[model samples]
Target chain A: MGRFVIRRLLQAIPVLLGTTFLIFAIVYALPGDPIQALAGERRVDPILAATLREQFHLNDPLIVRYGYYLRDIVSGNFGTTFRGLPVSTIFEGKFAVTLKLATTALLFEAVIGIGLGLWAALRRGRWEDKAILAFTLLLVSIPTLVSGFVLQLVLGVQLKTSLGIAFFPVAGVQDGIRSYLLPGFVLATVSIAYLTRLTRTSLMETLRADYVRTAVAKGMPRSRVLGRHALRNSLIPLVTYLGADLGALMGGAVITETIFNLPGIGQQLFTSVYLRENPVVVGIVTVLVLIYIVANLVVDLLYAVLDPRIRYE
Target chain B: MKNPSIDTHPPADEVAQEPLLVVDNLHVEFATRQGVVRAVNGVSYTVNAGESLAVLGESGSGKSVTAQAIMGILDMPPARIPKGEVRFRGTDVLQLSEQARGQIRGQRIAMIFQDALSALNPVFTVGWQIGEMFRVHRGMSRRDANNKAVELMDRVRIPAARQRVNDYPHQFSGGMRQRIMIAMAIALDPEVLIADEPTTALDVTVQAQIMDLLAELQRESNMGLILITHDLGVVADVADKIAVMYAGRIVEHALVHDIYKNPAHPYSKGLLDSIPRVDMKGQELYAIKGLPPNLLNMPPGCAFHPRCPYGRPNCVTDVPPLYEISGTRGSACHYYREVLDGTVQ
Candidate 1:
């Protein structure tokens, strides 16, 4: 397992390098010049502009500039923004909030998604299953941004309007568990639908498996047969979906972060894209890609735990 | 060595003296979109302790369904037992509540299935599955249950069972996986074991080995063994008595030797003749001429009449009652006298 982890981590090095290079190239090719944009429509000497370009390595060929960016990033130097603030510093504060939001949302997805899915499968072809199936379809059909706004309007504004209470957690609490709930739930909506669907389908198939019948023939209590035999077997596909979702969710947090007004990498990257901030964008993108790789590695290792038949060399 | 203390409840042994299982006129029908499909119709048989009863027939002949009904594992709505009584000793299992029947299942009359690869849960170790039988029924702790699982695996003659106890079902070969399944079924030392085509998925050599293992285990426990299969050759030696089914009814029932020597029903004779003999090398292998009747659209009279060599106009018009050939046998063909008296051959 240790060797596997090392190998996976080693593999991520090249992916990280490639992602940084490609993203840096894309950001470099953007129409706006960062130094001139930083000059902000105000008059400046050509010498000052030249000096700024040289300082940032912008005057060099794109390849040379990318080489420097890669080296600086490798050495843990994300380089300073044009405003003179370190990109690392900006990301550090924001990464924590996004992590909290993403993790909370993931927790919500796991609990509600798996629970509803299992319940729906147990009650398959019944009213409960139909209701959940319809509810999840509606959830999936609605666009994420729209759902976010609608949730904000209802849970944030109308809950206070109708209930006469501070229903929005963010109102009083800041960066706490309660504060994360509204945004986290909003973020979890699409994933919950996906997870519920995944869980239900996998569980339905697993429930019908011959092994489940064997367990039943073993005279196992109906609950244990479903819980231990069926549920565990079904969890394999669900776990795969979950890990991939989480990996993707690390970067996919942009809209959710923006909607909730959370200062995370997603929001930071979003705001920086408009300003054409290369270093900050590449840094955040690189971190999220690395995070995604790590999440997949965890998922791979978890497979051995979930299923004994899947042994790593 | 690990008996699992079946004597934990006294009288379970005394209860076995009457008969391990008795299925009386079991009628299992599946309600489908088109109509009610008759799966097991008026099937009756008895299995005694320390005896093996092989319910033999071609596919869709209701042998497995009858076994499922007796085990109370048949899915309802799709499958309904309109009229039946599965008597375990004296009590009718069909009349019992689901919970009461569950206690009787793995604890009293366990079952093994064909295709061990699919039957054993892929995620769990063989020991864990075997241990589960103990853990759930006896409320054994994880450590004790695991130890018990290893013991069961070892008893089933799995080589180096201690090391292999943690191995998943996929790690084992076909025959070894079947052994693991048998181990799980016998974990509780149940009074009866219904093996539904248990050797069908195995090769000839592995099939023989599995049958041998089953016979050995049955001897050790004196358990009533219901070996369900379509292959006459596979069960000839293992089964003390054979019940040949046509469609959903038992067309013939007799001691294995008597049935093999003088099959009372034409269907039974046809089945026995289809067994390819080494002495008859290069001779055309005989196969029963017609297809088994579809339950949804069964023929009006004897389901096997269309395929029977001795079939006549009367046979096509009538469903023959099982004729009493002797004290120990019955045949369901109208022309049983010629078939039994060696005049037909």
Candidate 2:
């Protein structure tokens, strides 16, 4: 297992390099000069402009600049923003908020998704099953952007005002965990729908499996058969989906963050892109790529735990 | 050696007149889109302690469904027991509440399936799956259940039971996996062990070994063994009696030797003749003509008439009842005497 983990981590190097390169190249290729955009509508002195360009390695070719960026990253320097703030320092608080939001969304997805799915699967073809299916379809149909704003207005503002209760904060994390609940659910809507369907299908198939019948034949009670045998087997695919979705939730929180006015990496990523803060953009993407790799590795390792047939070399 | 003093229930041996397990007039039907499939229709059989009954049939003949009904494992929405009584030692298990039936399930009557890889839970170790019988039913501690699992594994003749206890079902060979299934079934020392085509998925040599092991285990425990299979060859040595089914009904039933010698039912005669013999070296291998009847659209009369060599015009319009041939035999054929006397072409 140790050797397998080492092999997986080593494999992550190329993936990290590839993703970082792609983001860096895309940022470099964007139409507009960062230094001129920094000066914005001002006629700066040519000498000062030249100095700024040279200082930032903006005069160099894309490949050479990427090489320098890679060297800095290898030496533990994620570079500084045009505003001269270290990108890592800028990331500190924002990463935490994004992490919390993503965690919240994931918890919502796991609990509600698996719970509804198990319920639906057990009571398949009934009205409860049909209602859950229709609810999931509704969730899947609506985009996160619309759901985020509409929910913010209804639950965050309208409900709070009507009830004359400070139930939900309109925007930001001022209310700590409670502030994230609405936005977290909005962010989780589509995923929860997908996960519910996956869980339902998986559990249904698992329940019909020969092993479940064998469990029943073993005189195991209905609960044990479903809980121990069926549920455990079905959880394999759900775990994989959830693990991959964590990285996705973090990266895809841009719209959610903006709608809720949350001070997260997603908002930082948005502003950084508009301002042409190439260093900050690359740094954030690099971290996300690392997370994606690590999450996948953890998922693969978890497979061995969940299913003994999947032993790694 | 590790027999933890299991609570001594009333010995099934005391009830000599009442067979260990009796499946009487059990009718199972599946409600599908096309129509209700009559899977098991009026199938009645008795299994005595220490005796082996081989239920012989082609696929879809309802032998497995009958077993599932007796086990109370059939899914209700698709499958329904319209009328039946599965009596275990005198008590009708089918009439009992689900909880009562659950107690009787692995504790009193256990079952092994054909495909061992699919039957054994893939996520759990063989020991855990086997030990589950004791853990859930007997309320044994994990350690005690595990030790009992190892003991059962050893009893089933799995090599290096201690070493392989933690291995998954996929790690074992076909025969070895079936042994694990058998081990789990017998872990509770059930009074009746129903093996539903247990050797169907095994290699020829391995099949013999599994049958021998099952026979040995049954003898030691004095358990009633219901060996359900399609192979006539697999039954000869182990089975004391046979029940031949065709289209969800028992067409013939007799002492294993008696039926093999002179099959009264034409369908039974056809099955016995289909068995390849070295003495008839150059002769064409005989096969029962046509397919088994579809459960949803069964023929009006005898379901086997389409495939029977002795099928007559009357056979197409009339369903023959199981005629008592003698003291220990019954044949569901109108022309049983002609078939038994070798007077029919």
Report the lDDT tens digits of candidate 2 across residue range A114-147: 9999999998999999999999999999999889
Question: Which residue pairs collide, candidate 2?
Answer: none
Clashes of 1: 0
lDDT of 2: 0.91
Stretches of candidate 2 above 4 Å error? A41-53, A58-61, B1-14
Model 1: how far residue B232 lies from native, Å: 1.5
- iRMS, model 2 (angstroms): 0.6
State candidate 2's DockQ: 0.85
The CAPRI-style docking tier of model 2 reads high
Clashing pairs in 1: none
Report the error of model 2 at residue B129, Å: 1.7
lDDT of 1 at A271: 82
Q: Chain A only: give the TM-score of model 2.
A: 0.95
